[model samples]
Target: MWPASMPGSILHTAEVPAFDPRTGQLSLASHDLISAPLSLADVFPPEYTLLFDPSPSRPYGTSTSAADADQPAGQSRRKRRRLARPDETASPLDWIRHREKEATRSSTDKESDEHHAAIEAELGTAVEAVRAGWMGKGEDAWMGESKGRYEWREKEDEDVKEELDLVGLGERFAPALDEPPEPLLLSESRSTVSAAALFHRIVRNDGSSCISLDIEVDASEATPTSKATVILPPSSGFLLSQLATWPASAPSIASLGGEKGGWDVLIVDPPWPNASATRSSSYDTFDPYDLWKLDLPTMLGDSPTLVAFWLTNRVKFRRLLKDKLFPAWRIQQSAEWYWIKIASETGEPVWPLDAKHRRCYEGVLLGYYVPLGTKVDLPTLPQNKVFLSTPIGHSRKPFILDLLRPYLLPRDRPPNVLELFARMTLQGSFRRSATDEDGEGDQQKPGIFLAVGNEAIKFNIVDGSAAAGSVRGWLRRQEDTERVCAAEEAV
Candidate 1:
């Protein structure tokens, strides 16, 4: 049974300071802005005893230890046959067999060629626009001529090391399930939804007991327990609910501001399908066309709304965003940015600028929604900019509030923000991760509404280590200003 001290209501409400309209800048008061590169383990520590490394160092098509053994017999046998082939060469029979299969598959797949050509045409136009704008920016530009070759072993080694560290942590902190876990109280006056209320249990899956949220559990009957308590920083505020619940919840969230109507910023990171993602069995992927059906435009406020989309590099997906999705949403493409994955050790790209198989960067498409006949002066958005960072965990992108601050609406107070398909929870009062080593204290605060699927709630808690060394420069400048103010007061 849970303690009576825990709130009975699933939702808690707290008054947060409104964004200062004069600045048009995002408040990072709740976020630890220390600019240090963090390891994958630092951002998302091993919560369960079983740690599974999805990306292994095995040769292409070869099965790793983590590969599912229960695959169909035919598939397993096929993979085994491929593995049994000689390293440097294939038998003439094997070559002939592969050629026959390819020929048969190609002959039957005529529609694929037409689809590829259509996507290629759309991609070529977008790339040409980018090249035209960045042509004179010189070699220092992100789109500068690439050498077209890379050595990816270092990055792979780093991934392996991080994976091992997670495994070690899991082994060290394996939870005991013989007895009921103790209930943990996470108290914060500003948190509208407590972490205790959001997560029901840490269950083991495939050997590891990572932090998992049982959203299916009835909130009224839930008696959740956590291994640790998390007190959130002041600037954090989150609403924990399934993505389907947002339409019902948005009106209430908007009503909090009386006349705000809807959100000023909408950020979405949909789990778009890809061949690599399909193979890994990570999160469930959705069809790109299904995105067009979402009633996203209805959530936009009367004022100009900023919409940022995290996009995969597939040409077909890009076309869907530009042609189908944007048109349906009535959003005009303003600019595009790249999230470049760099090495934590050397600060260089994990893969070279032009890796043939995989590029080291992902795309972010930014757009704005404007109602008809609404004329407003907006800041010119920079094009083709690169945001550099070492990625942590699967598909966990960098937090770009600092980079996005400049372009946010300059209303009287900070623009209200909203995130769809959100993984990371940003709310008033940021919570420290159990694995955080810096002993960073919490601050009370507020943020925008977040809507995600049930599976995404596990990543909603704050990760203090994500910014580690990355924010030090910015933090130092802030401290220097404070020191000068203190010295002046003393005089």
Candidate 2:
């Protein structure tokens, strides 16, 4: 339903008021600010482990012998314990019970009758019997039952209390009678706009409507522990095989040639379509977007906002964005940032290095053009640069949330930001990951997480050999040796 008080001309902005039917109050819902939880595992899961050499500065002594390496020199390192596969027949608690019983049987109590009485009274039923494993079997069994029953009762009561507390919190935070109306899910449902509206808005040159071509797509289902390929929506009956035969609805890949839009802010990362003969060679030589062909006109679709597009330093790709892509998108160039890519192998100062390894940073293209009639808060560009030194995989885009801070809403409260085809995790931003990495798998350690940011920048030497220059490097090498020991143990 169209908002009762909305002006038909501007439906996208929050400046337009929406009325609540329940309370009869006017309110605003801005789509700009999004709330996304900061987590990697939500989008991507680890499928397999990849090993890379640690930086030379930090070195761990590698050993040939397992026994010597496991207990290296002065440091007493606990061997990485490999967990056994669970038993299907019995519950885990049963195994705990078995261990406890065995421990009780073997344990010795060296105490007077007064101490023994205190221990028995304090330990309670099962624990007391377990402690008195030196005692008779009947006594142990009787005490175990008593302790077990008490524990169960206590746990049940705690659960009941927690449930009641949650109910109370729910009541306290309930919406007031005069609250504004919740937003309808326009993206998923109640969408009035269609491809036809977009097509009419762009194709204004000649009135002869072209035939639309149909393309079939098949979405693949991901396994519990695997990455999945996405299938685009299947083609309708509209069929045109060759690019030349493409109808008005579907422009040819060639004609997808840039026709820029008039936008206040623009963010684009054109996939400089580059072909490759082999898959392995593609990462270093081929354009990252070689496979994903995008239509510039279709992508812009009359968006009037600040525009920024990610680009590489590749001569052809750089030239395409500067000369063709930017012009086609109708974005006025404003600023550029060099993302100095550094590998750990290049050593300390994270900068461009060619002697050890060819390293380069990404070039972020920022551009904007004043809208003829649009009112927007022009963002102030940052003079100071930010350096994110972590080694990311190829084509792993920088966090827009981190980079586009200058172009944010000037509000005390958190601003709403939306990400399209985003993969890396962000805090408090609405996200739609085309290929998400949830930071799952063996990397998600129980007590420690993979540290990044300031903490990562500040080096700390863990208790280890001085001969081994860096502790982190040592730990990583130890991880491999531990893996071998685990394999042998399994055998």
Candidate 3:
């Protein structure tokens, strides 16, 4: 079983400043320069010296009153007032400082309120759009099933939970396991395959028990495998060999037919560690620095690459994305969009817009990877757009294919897509499948490749062939389904 939180075994100890959920604020030992509001003195310095408390006990500085007794010990308690110049009065200096503080506070408050209001309005509009016959017919049915399963899991008795101990299970049961020499291919026409097949394939072919597969459509001679999904185990040697042929600056795209070029669109949802995730024990989290270790820049194509990063609302996480992660990947930040979660029943935010603990929305940070000296024409991505939807489960993001389809490069042919740290398969069907039908059931040609850790293989694999037709059609059907469900939910 996947660890409830990022496995304790992984290196998750990255020190981020603690935050207070009650106040929706960070608890910093010292003020963060990035988050601090700009002031007139910040832009144009005064000639006179000003002495104020360094501690942020108050907005301007530490209070001079008896409130110092309530503050923690060792903190600076020496109260100092702003010094006046020989030409200026003390009252004038005090007024200037007070005005600057008030201006900063006003700017911060206005930005915060506007952000909250935008979330509310966008969420409400999306809900109304679904209600106005925009949802697909089968969309709500599938959603209902998923919602039911989620509810059941939540209501299930904790004592009755089945625990699978994987620590030593593999070594104990399968001592002679070896890495598979070739990839495992499963077909619907062939006998049904299961996790047992994965094990057998690994042992028979001398492949690693912890191998992850890349799914592709088999265009060879017609058989049970014709147009069927072929799962290829990731080969480090194969990848390195292919990378050797490409220019050092360009991304190496993996082809189904073993051709050149790299993934055109990359979607990454890093498992950023957080306090809520730790408390819930629902999924694992990773240290922010570990994200830099991912060789994402090596996976891009020669063309301009569009990369979308799912980000948390935390200030530290956003800072890491803008400051470190984007720069390390050689991708420039282009746009930041909000994914606002609405109520399935009321169309309002699932949480209040001003909720202190959990905000109603998350962020999608979009960036582009432009190879040096390469000028590629790319579509402009709108900044600060809001995508409203009722989320399915914890950490599960709404499908954004329809939202981002227009902005993809090489509009003629299908774009090659890859998802990193993927929890579920990215089938073109726009619906999460319950079983591994492969890609046979999809109406659209499959172009997405998924890579995840071995522990995550328990979930369904990608069915490249299953994703058929245009994304617009799937989105229309989804809206129709949501519309019907919303009506029922309101009733």
Candidate 4:
């Protein structure tokens, strides 16, 4: 069983002075400079290392006045004003936020009573969990809220925001006509370039251009028995073809039901068709059920392998998983968990808990696929449990591996980890996370952390502004830590 007692803070974060967004750019003082290269754990301390007094996520009230009346006032009205609040002086950005909020709130209010009770109970659980963890929404990052708001929200997202589905690319192997698609294969693996001497270093001075260089970051460590394998993008037709043949590539996929050489844990973050751009903005929304084409059962390791599915707040999507998707995959329904996105400065939900536009919290449905084995080796996850983290970017998610580590198969067995629609790298950068800083828990052995998606390497590059020939890209910012990194789209 998982631990019963809860700690005060689940993850450790670096506290830095807040940068005032009223002014145009990210200045040096406000930024927490990384003296060295970062590893996956350094960017987002999985657990042991790493806010808010918000309403009970299930829609408090729609009074705009009541919303801002309690929020702290500041000098820069535009930057400090809470999101979803509308006013005469508000700009285009404000109105966009307002409309989205209103739509969400209205819909949630009209939910059928049959489902309302369960939604209400789960949401209330998230609110309490966040409030307990926030511990007064620590005051240090208050000024930096402005920078955090647009941290990795680069101007380039407008250009190719729509995703070209790799899963359903059924063509006659026709390559790009204009200029032969020269797939760039960049590898940041355990062998070359340890985290200490990184090719992708980060710096946050005034002059940084947001460029997505095709970099394959392989975040793996060398244990005696098993060696970790990272599958990254080739950035062209090759990538699509490569992913299409994933099932055939592994002989283990031969038997979807019988436990041969299959994965121990499987995570799915499908691009559900929805109106909002929150995460779906970048991906070309398509029939989510298309995922069955991959033949999931062929990938299960042993009996009762863990499977976690991320879903939006939409009831239809939730029902699809509980009803259609799970049954087809033969996965037994289990626990549901929620992740609450809180403001770094205010220690409140980035958006209202049950805002009309978007809810600050999303859910994860956990289940076990019982195959040939009689029992699951992993411990049980709590039902309707909630965890909190500062919002990073439109798509980035915190490393849940840390929370689930203890419950996973022991290091020697080295469970195969697989993630679908992983817009960002699971292990993050292939750089060295400082050993001294990550000395808390026992480290994971050389296990496969395969992150599969069209934009799998989309958020894997190091992001930062350029100086006279310093490292070009560096991850912008992490969920709670002062350090930053490139991450991506999901619930």
TM-scores of the candidates are 0.50, 0.33, 0.50, 0.54
User: In candidate 3, what are the lDDT values of residues 150-249, reduced to their tens digit?
Assistant: 2212223223322222112222323232322233433222233322233212211112111333322222242112121212221211211111122321
lDDT of each: 0.43, 0.28, 0.41, 0.44
Model 3 vs. true fold: TM:
0.50
Comparing 2 with 4 on TM-score, the higher-scoring candidate is 4
Model 3 C-alpha lDDT versus the unseen true structure: 0.41
Winning candidate number (TM-score): 4
Q: Pick the candidate with the highest lDDT.
A: 4
Q: Model 2 compared with the native: what TM-score?
A: 0.33
- Worst 10-residue lDDT window, candidate 3: 31-40
Candidate 1, residues 377-468: lDDT per residue as tens digits?
77756555445544544776655554566676675443455666765443321222232234443222223333343343334332112222
Please report how far candidate 2 places residue 194 from its true position, in Å: 24
Candidate 4 lDDT, 208-323, residue by residue in tens: 11122332223334211111122222111112222344454233332322322345677777777767654444455657666657666666644456788888777766777888
Mark the regions of model 4 whose C-alpha exceeds 4 Å error after superposition: 1-9, 12-117, 140-262, 278-280, 373-378, 409-415, 428-444, 462-491
RMSD of 4: 15.3
